[model samples]
Target: MSILRLPARQQVRVLLLSSLVMLAACGEKPQQAGGEMKVPVSVVTVEPTPTEVFVELPGRVEAIKEAEIRARVNGIVQEINFEQGSDVKSGQLLFTIDPAPYIAQRDQAAAQLKNAEADIRSARLFADRYAKLIKANAVSRQEYDNAVAQAGQAEAAVAAAKAALQSANINLGYTRVESPIDGRIGRSMVTEGALVSAASATQMATVQQLDRVYVDIPRSVNQLAQLRRAMAEGVLTRSAEGDALAYVLLEDGAEYEHPGKLLFSGVSVDPGTGQVSLRAEFENPDQILLPGMYVRVRLQQGMDEKALLVPQQAIQRTSDGLNSVYVVREGKVQPVAVSVGPQIKGSFLVYKGLNPGDVVVVEGFQKIRPGAAVQPIPWKQAGAKPGSQPGGPAGAQPEPEATPKG
Candidate 1:
């Protein structure tokens, strides 16, 4: 059955069939050694580790000591001694009020006192002479009584004059305004020659102690209750230091260089916000922290002796806002729902739905589906140093579900 020995038309049909067969053979896909291609993924074996837990809350910076410099007496501002926005010492003269009027009042009071003293001396001398004359029967009893009454009135006048003099001296002293505390003074509210009044309590400046600042943190009452419950249940053990240790983060996201200590927790809750106030103190020798600055406080709430942590990237959220992770079990991909808790160091505390020894994929999950076989590999964090150990336990990875940014 050689095609070359057949008729010319049959030979042509054979040649066409031969060409079709060769094309089919060239188009056929080559068979691989393995039965199915497994998707390569990075994974981490879940393991329990001892870790510290922290709670972060919004806080406000406040000066520990604040004083409003106000006018204590009514007068025209004669001088401003300290520079604006400069450090000041206690009892330092900050301003001077017009002292001319006060001085004149003081002098008048002194003159009145001297006059009252002279009148009292003359009245007392007459009263003494009258008493001696009465004993000797040299003057009428009625005249002696009148002299004694006149001496008593003079003495009362002298006392009133002394009180007036004291008041005048006090007023004179008020003309020289001084700082009551050691702190940094703000801008002068009143200029030189400006009229200031005691009645109005006109503010001249502000001084605040900035060397140490207080961080006021307010947490909702509900949150405090939950924390208490956790502590009671033995789920969260309070730190031995309690609220003593604290860390602050600036508004610009930079961590403050110095650490702080908690002062006290408010006994009463705020009626408006139902929040309990907490205060912490931090050394601000550099004066970087200013009053009213927005900051974040990190407080160590408790410790979990045995806890499971998953990389933040491995946790997946669905459209309805449920969290899950792709776990590799028995060489097959499985989407397992997971319950997560507070995050620490780019990893989340897995409170539920995950167990020790579970291989969770951290990368390359997009290419696979449920029940699909995968080749799990050590998931190395990007930008890691050369020859560094992989991320997480044994290194996990993720796929179509987006990898969350740390």
Candidate 2:
């Protein structure tokens, strides 16, 4: 069987046959050589659960009550009684105006009142005498009438003096400016020796009640209308009487420890922004919240009893902006279109196109194609090590295996 012993044509034919056999072997598919192709993937079985929906809106902190301290009388500021940025009580004296002029005016009014009282006593005695003399005809009728008229005029002057005295006393009391509310006071706008007057109404300081604070949040009018429509359609549920709960996120991204209650939602939209205003009340005993500070408010709008949730990573958006998810159906990969709602934590609320008990691939979707057979594995979080199984022991059944497919 030596090629050298054979003829040239036979040698050429043998070489050609050998080359054809090697090419045929190389052309065979790898899967056919061993077994059917199966892509390994992680999946989660969909389930319906009660979920709470929250709307986050930008808000600003405001004082529950704000009072502007102003001078009520014309006088020079003699002293500032309270330290700048200190807490003050209601009716506590905050400033003292020079009381010299007011005191002099009050004394003058008192003296006038005393003189009027002396005149009143004299007039009463004269009127009594005139009445008796006229009855007895001891004095002429014209003389008696003139005496009675003088007494009445004196009485009228006394009444006017009394009113002037009261006015003076009131002005004297206004010299001491007091806090109208119990709150933290700001810096003094006018220092000692500065002139303040009632006519101009000079601002002395500002006080704001800070034990409880208000958070004013502006929400889009369109968004609010959509939420109402959803509620009417029975897609959302809320308590008819009680206010919704709220939580605050500070500017630095830290959440406040205490929760708040929504006070009210505005009925009218703002003309400038077309937004509805919402207010929440929070306990700020520590003064952690200050007026005009910006914050984010998380308001619980409503609850959905039957909500479908999926991991955010499992959702894929195509070039056309259509959202979709890949699911394993009948041991093969399948693509499904889904309508997603607001994001809840790390998951999204699935609104449409997906049913409970469907196995959706959360990982390894890139390795599988439509209609391709896939070996579905339990989906582990990103924190888990590669090849490690989720859930408990190896004997534990996966969620998809335990749940009855719809």
Q: RMSDs, each prediction?
A: 6.4, 7.4
Task: State residue 292's C-alpha deviation in candidate 2, in Å.
Answer: 0.7
The runs of at least 3 residues in candidate 2 whose Cα sits more than 4 Å from the true structure, single-residue gaps closed, are 1-36, 137-153, 239-241, 332-335, 365-373, 382-406
Inter-residue clash pairs, candidate 2: none
Taking all chains together, each candidate's TM-score versus the true structure is 0.81, 0.80
User: lDDT, candidate 1, residue 346?
Assistant: 64
Tens digit of lDDT per residue, candidate 1, span 1-406?
Answer: 8888999999999999999999999999997687778999988877777655666788899999999989888999999999999999999999999999999999999999999999999999999999999999999999999999999999999999999999999999999999989999999999998999999999999999999999999987776776676667766666666565778877776778998998888999889999999999999999999999988887666666566787789999878888999999889999998777666666777777887888999999689999999999977766766544222321111111221111
Question: What is the C-alpha lDDT profile of model 2 across 88-205, one tens digit per residue?
Answer: 9999999999999989999999999899989988988998898999899999999888888988888888898899899999999899899999999999999999999899899999
What is the C-alpha local distance difference test score of each model? 0.83, 0.82
Residue 351, candidate 1: C-alpha displacement in angstroms = 2.6
lDDT of 1 at 227: 64
Question: Which regions in candidate 1 have their CA more than 4 angstroms from the true location?
Answer: 1-34, 123-152, 382-406
Candidate 1 has what TM-score? 0.81
- Top candidate by TM-score: 1
